[model samples]
Target: MSDFLIDEELLAAIDMGSNSFHLAIARLDHGEVKKVVSMSEKVQLAAGLDDNNNLTDVAQQRGLACLSRFVGRLSSVQANRLRIVATNALRQAKNGQDFIDKAAKILPKPIEIIAGREEARLIYLGVSHTMANGGRRLVIDIGGGSTEFIIGEQFEPIYTESLQMGCVAFTNKFFADGEINVKNFNKAVSAATKELLAIANVYKEEGWETVVGSSGTIKACRQIIINLGWSDEKQTITRTGVEKLKEKLLKYKHISELDFEGLKEDRRAVLPAGFAILYAIFNVMDIDRMMYSDGALREGVMYDLLGRFKHEDIRDRSVQALVGRYNIDIKQAERVVKTAQKLFDDVAESLKLTNEDSDLLRRAAYLHEIGLAISHGGYHRHGAYVLEHSDIPGFSQIDQNCLSHLVAHHRRKIKADLKNEVLKVGTPALVYLCLLLRLAVLLNHSRSDQMLPAIELTVLNEQQWCLTVSGDAKQWPLLVADLHDEQAQFKHWNIDLIIQSEKFID
Candidate 1:
């Protein structure tokens, strides 16, 4: 295969979980993602955290080494075709960015640390793709660092949440000494129960006809129950089997003494804690049984990447949803988006802007007035906060921040500190996108059905640019004054902005 494929193309997604790191490779087979390869390493990244939640050097080394091996498997994968995402362990680490900095030298692409809710969304997507047309399924995935609960139908999730309790984290809290007594086991269950309590009622209200368990912990439990002859139904986990396993589990005082058929040696250490969490879920939500799905986070990611390449991006849906929810002026938004896109096309090559940056500019233009829904005073700041905090389905945390910065400075004086935040995205394109959005909004200040005259943007050089408004200058007094007023802002931005009308000269 070539570096990039037009058909039957290979797409990849890596899930850097708290307990294990996984890489899944697939190819687009008639608009569906078919698996090519699946690989995972038990790096125990969550266990590597010190008391202060800093990832230890030893843990970082373990993760880096594993990633090095993964890179060997990805030699044929194109950089743009791969997506790497980190879950709760990285999110909780104090020096997560420090670790990401070092890993950037090794991986094919930069790592995206996703928010908790976003993680749940992807997990649901993965489970939905591999399963049958089971209506209203509740999926629960137990990982090393955190557990995700999602109630979704088909590919869309109805409710998604990530709880802080996970198998590895619980093991550290209640089973650190390797002992698994009734006291400690119940305590672990109780703690997990407490974590689920907050969301139990809402999930219960939004009931599901079927339940699914995914990832390492639940998979191991299903296997162990079958191996121990506790469940006659080999593929399913039953309530009776769980009770039998619980009775037998408490009989052993330590994890080392407990052995069941089909249990992997690697999962031995965390199995007890994993069982406790599952037990809590079974009781709290009154679940009868849950079918296990082999697919999870990584699979969902590949399918999502497939959507982006096909131009059916969920981010577009998210933006449109906000527009409808806020009752935004659709006509006005369309005007700004059209002008912003033209501006981007004019200066894209000179500024080294990519299609992604152009997309950001369009989305920002449409959402610039989102804050007016809350309050007219400092609405830009309010809009920024909304973007930063809203759980838009497909946006990564950094994606939200980038959009937030653009919306925040659309009309007001651009803050100096914003440059630093923009740089964290590993791009200077945001600086240019911010300018394009600002000018687009300024051009559409009239918010009239009558279209404005033809506007042209030219890049004189790297540090200089000119906006030439065509047609009669006398008719555009408000826009003319706005352009002149923006001159001082340009003076401090290291760019010489020349704004004038074709009918006149500056």
Candidate 2:
């Protein structure tokens, strides 16, 4: 909220797709976003990944060059108002962090690698916003490295899945040589169908009133079908249209020899591969017709940003749902949340904690004890696992990872290596947040509504934090022991957690 402007505010989203990187800049008018600027480049980040799942230097450089250009077009947007999300390629790359680290230097903001389901959710959001809302719809997005299938009514996704097959990835795997013979074409379709095998039965059973397609690959296919006069009068991609395209595709022995009217040069190479995927979906899912929508992930990201600015953050709703589902003690969670907020306020400036970081801390605090629902024994570990693995909409993988770290370390004896294992960078800052969470959890151990004494937390320095508790230390023996234990835990993390009762401070 601190970084957003209410009226005529500019918001931007960079969708780092495996095949292409896109930037969308928009201005919020009333409750809608009007397109301001859009830019995209074929980075083919996924194609650069080798067998070892590492992005080659060439690929990294290509990505960075494109990001630098994207940064130039973002001159008018504030850093906080922008969201950059990477999909399958970054999620699959073993050395993604290295690429992200390099790209961070050239980009305006940190790149968030989203999970597949989150991608599906956002894709649905984008599609729903731009399409007519009535019946349940099935949306498909064929990306460079992954394909997302989502079933939803209006904006809410009922079923979301991200399969490990995409146009670019499939091309590299099955059609790397650009040959389009029947053997290779069948192989690609069969492979995609195999991946869909798991979800086909369930999705078909649930059904949908309409089928929609998004992303560049789908858009390209739709245009090619229409241009070739393969589609129906409404320009919808029909089963007959797809079958005709497939028949035309197998005629060419190689991709290079093929030429179509509406297909662009940049999209020509991957068209066959993308078409194979689309054909497979049609056959496997029993799809009769599909309509294309201009809205996709970037548009969804813009809408999500608008929601955040309007205090309708979906992540908060996600946390609340988790809390309720786990049957967590609401009063106790509030206690920890309130205390964590107070502690965060005290050291926010000193620790350079941004509003987003504060939000993460608060959400982590509320869900800290969610693991108790599983077992009180090692509940922290269970909680961490849940937060790390659960499909919570509106939360990116990074957000979930940070929350998992805070929850994992909230009540445990600080393992010296835990800090390094749980965090790659920002170890100190995360450890500090973890320390605050531990203190809040410790202070609320009693879980009573009794009034707490005035407490003040101060940052004496990077390695020292002083807490003053205005109460009779003798009366709160459990709290005193808890504080002492926390002091030792802080020490393990190389922080001096000093505490003083009113009398001791005096």
For candidate 2, lDDT tens digit of each residue in 1-506? 47445768889999999999999999888778778898989999999999999999999999999999999899899888999999999999999999988987888788888999999999998889888656999999999999999999977899999999998999998889988888888899999999999899999999899999998999998998899988988899999999998898888888888788877888988988899999999999999999999999999999888888878898999999999999999999999999999999988898887788788889999999999999999999999999999989998887888899999999878877877875684446777788889888888888998877678899899889999898687667777777877888888877898887755431
CA lDDT, candidate 2, residue 66: 94
Per-residue lDDT of candidate 1, residues 1-506 (tens digit): 12224667789988999999999988887777899999989999999999999999999999999889888899878888899999999999999889999999999788988988889999999999999767999999999999999998889999999999998999999999999899999999999999999999999999999899999999999988888776655368888889998998899888898788778888989999999999999999998888889889999998887778778788899999999999888999999999999989988888888877877888898899999999999999999999999888888877888899899878877656666666776477887787788888988899886868787888898788898878887787887888877766665566778976658444
CA lDDT for candidate 1:
0.88
Give candidate 2 misplaced runs (Cα > 4 Å).
421-427, 504-506
Displacement of residue 254 (Cα, Å) in model 1 is 2.2
In Å, residue 153's CA in model 1 sits off its true spot by 1.6
User: Which parts of model 1 have CA positions greater than 4 angstroms off?
Assistant: 1-6
